[model samples]
Target: MSSDIAQPTTATGHARQYGDRALQTLLSANRALLRAEQVNALYQEMCRIIVETGGYAMAWIGIARHDPGRSVDAVAHYGDRDGYLRDLRISWADVANGRGPTGTAIRTESVQINHDFECNPRMEPWRERARSHGYRSSLSIPLRDERAVFGALTLYAREPDAFDGAELELLNQLAEDLSHGVRHLRLRQEHAHNARLLRRSLFATIEALTVALEKKDPFTAGHQRRVSRLSARIARELGVSDFDIEGIRIAAQLHDVGMIQVPSELLVKTGPLTPDDYDLIRRHARAGFDILEPIDFPWPVAEMVHQHHERIDGGGYPRGLRGERILLGARIIAVADTAVAMNTAKPYRETPGPDATLQALRDGRGTAYDPAVVDACLHLLRDLREAA
Candidate 1:
């Protein structure tokens, strides 16, 4: 170390020089913090504001690492660094290397200051570089939250004993503000991640339920899934919004869920159903609505299930909802359900080809089915044929 030592300086002189700039730094950072949406941008701009507005020689934010090594990594920096970090190593351990302002502030959870770089024994390793860079003083203020200290904001100045008691207190308040910012960003990221996980879980559970229904009725093994795919395709072709399309697809998958309550023998009877059996089968739509109403779905799923069998001409089962009174999701599921059912074999009728299904849709476009849905379904089917 050199012979130059920092004597007790006049508090009034240092306070007068930096008081105005310190207040401005705090105000500027608070403004930027209000609009910061990401972590990197928040710290990088913070470093810039501190060095440019606060009149500091250099400023950096160092975050502590505990797993691999007890080292402080300088994540964000502004102003002149001048190779100061190339030969410098600081830790929060109880050793000589951890005695510097940065390390001491982090370890002790308080402000650490080196009023003189050339003569201070704690800053001996940095004296030569500090002298060449015209830096005479350093301040390390801990970045803390409610629980513990996570890092430190290390700053340098050209004047000896530049940071007085008043300045240190102001800097501490700035560090606390940064801690709140970091906490806010972390909570937002965690919430978004959790939302994605919840959606995935809900989808897996619903798909499993649909599969179980398929196993119970072997003749309709993949009927619901096929109707779901077709319903989604028609909705997209009709220019339905993504949100409604998702609801339509989900509703189609579970539209026949009430069939589970029907007797298994009646499902594969291979003959026309008796009046009693027909009545039980007709009650399936209402039964499905009751079973699904208890669960809180994001969409109008239960209502769609209850309305899927209703006709637009007041000629269809359970409740004969006519015209535009039927829900859009229910309407889409109806078209897809009829098309797939006509194509597949059933106890009541033999399987018809795709052309026959199209003919049925053409004949009943406005009377039974919604005209727009029929048109969209036809368009999608025609495109697939042309592409093939």
Candidate 2:
């Protein structure tokens, strides 16, 4: 691509113009790094800024591969309107093709400037390709990680000696900043991957505990699972974010964890529970909180479990939190748990069925249950019925 800028009449004017482009490129590079979220995005933006903002004819980024061929993979480019790199094949090995600006820059871990791509003997391999693309000069800057150079940012200019001392200084600084951006983004990506792995492990452990509890109490065998499913659905209908929905689902699955501390006989008893027995069962919420409070969860899992039994009217649970004071996840779980429990059959009572469960939620909306959660749950149940 042509530089497409007015040609300066004097040598002084030329140098001044070059300096301005370099400064603009550096500023744009800084902004790109701050806004960039991934390494590939950074590479693509760097090339684009160098071409459009710096007034380079063409620009591209190539990663040096350590495979058998030691090939340079052209990962990102701009201003290649003619597809200049379409059939490009280059390497970093000590071979003929590897002696070009991009390969040499990576090999030497320094900047490589081909002042005159037409006359330079080292440009023999790519000379024709360069001429065909109207590239008179080129600059290649090595991109490095914490350890060593891993890639090259190559730029082509319409004028010979386009990259002079002042411009070269700024371009070199841009390359350094680009390298740092790449390293930072890669580390962030790796950290996110590790965090996901750890979260999965934690979920597995929670699932095991839930399974053990279910095994101990046959009456509530699949109650937690049903609650988890309904809670997640209600959260989605309420437009809760994916991250918060995951937390709600997990909390709902483990909300009954406190019952493990209660006597198995009391849990399985078909007879009416005495007031003391009822109070003991009420203690399960706090017990579940204590069981989960020590674990380092990314979400408010312990608090959600503790507040699952809470009511919006400040009439329920250990703390009696009112209105918005109750955690949203817990509020969602409360609606789901109540609905699932009423619908599911128990040894001590007959199943109330879905119609009765919906009526119960409608009756308690706003006073006992969160109005919005009840609305979302009502919509979800309607959809389920329609789908059925």
Candidate 3:
């Protein structure tokens, strides 16, 4: 009889140890899942695990409004079909504001555990909705960063007393994991948004500068746009990656940004240029570099613009960089700018036809331009003519 009692006692101890190990494993997995910097991914994983573990019939996460006075927003929902989730946008006003479990949890910064929703006074109004959805009990755990409450993770179960002390503890751990993930994701998204805005502002400033330069030299009107279009075509023909092609297009559009600093009289003068005027013209590249050096850009757009006047044979100005030493984007823009200049009417020359322009490029191939880029430009023009 004593041996039987001892065996049962030992079995209970082992069972408790196994349960503790299982809880640790679950917490570790939750922590790992929450490290993802995507809010939707974190929410989906959390919901799937809770449903699989019989912790919930459905789950949802709501983010508090960015405005201090506004209602929270439902950002993530699980256990609902795609179409249903789309219509799950809820407002704090829709609930008895700060009355339901979720609202109460968020407002009080505590978990609202409804083991028996039918008898719970706090859940009285929400009881019918829960029952109609086949949820008899629910738990709402407040999600918080170090500073303050941000939202709540609400879990619904189909049976009463579904969440015991152990399950509530586990939910609390999951909530902490989720809060950290949410904070990280929000920060990343904000950074990306700010970057996009900064890039747009820089592009707008470049366009304004180009327009001002064009006004000073009416003969150069439409020059930057045409160069950008032609450069993009050449990049495509060369099978350059789309990212580099975009860089070339931007560089081409701003290639002559330094011309903004040149004297208007020097630009519009129809007479022959003095050596001093020529010198002023040569200074535009460095002027452009100086203007752009301070602005933060994702790529070396300023440097590419500065080098657009450079030649492959070590003959170009400002830096006189040679061959592959010049950025590929700068080389592509150089060919495009030269081609456009040769084919378009300028203050100093007549507009040559496309055939004459191609011949000139072929003649000056290695001396003034990158040979491979020139070949690509010729091929691009042929394709355009054929398409036309």
How does each model score on TM-score? 0.79, 0.81, 0.78
Off by over 4 Å in 1: 1-35, 48-57, 65-71, 78-83, 86-89, 129-134, 158-173, 322-325, 383-388
Clash numbers, per candidate: 0, 0, 0
What TM-score would you give candidate 2 relative to the actual structure? 0.81
- Those runs of model 2 whose alpha carbons end farther than 4 Å from true positions after fitting are 1-12, 81-88, 232-245, 263-265, 274-280, 310-328, 353-388
**Residue 20: error of model 2 in Å?**
2.4
Best of the candidates, lDDT? 2
lDDT of 1 at 137: 88
Give all candidates' CA lDDT scores. 0.82, 0.88, 0.74
Q: What TM-score does prediction 3 earn? A: 0.78
For model 1 the local lDDT of residue 288 reads 85
Worst 10 residues of 2 by lDDT: 1-10
lDDT of 3 by residue, 237-310 (tens): 88899988887888788888888899988887877888999999999999988888787765688999889889
lDDT winner, 1 or 2: 2
Q: lDDT tens digits, residues 138-255, model 1?
A: 8888887667898988889888777766666677778789889988887887898887898788688678768877777888888888889999988998889999888888889999
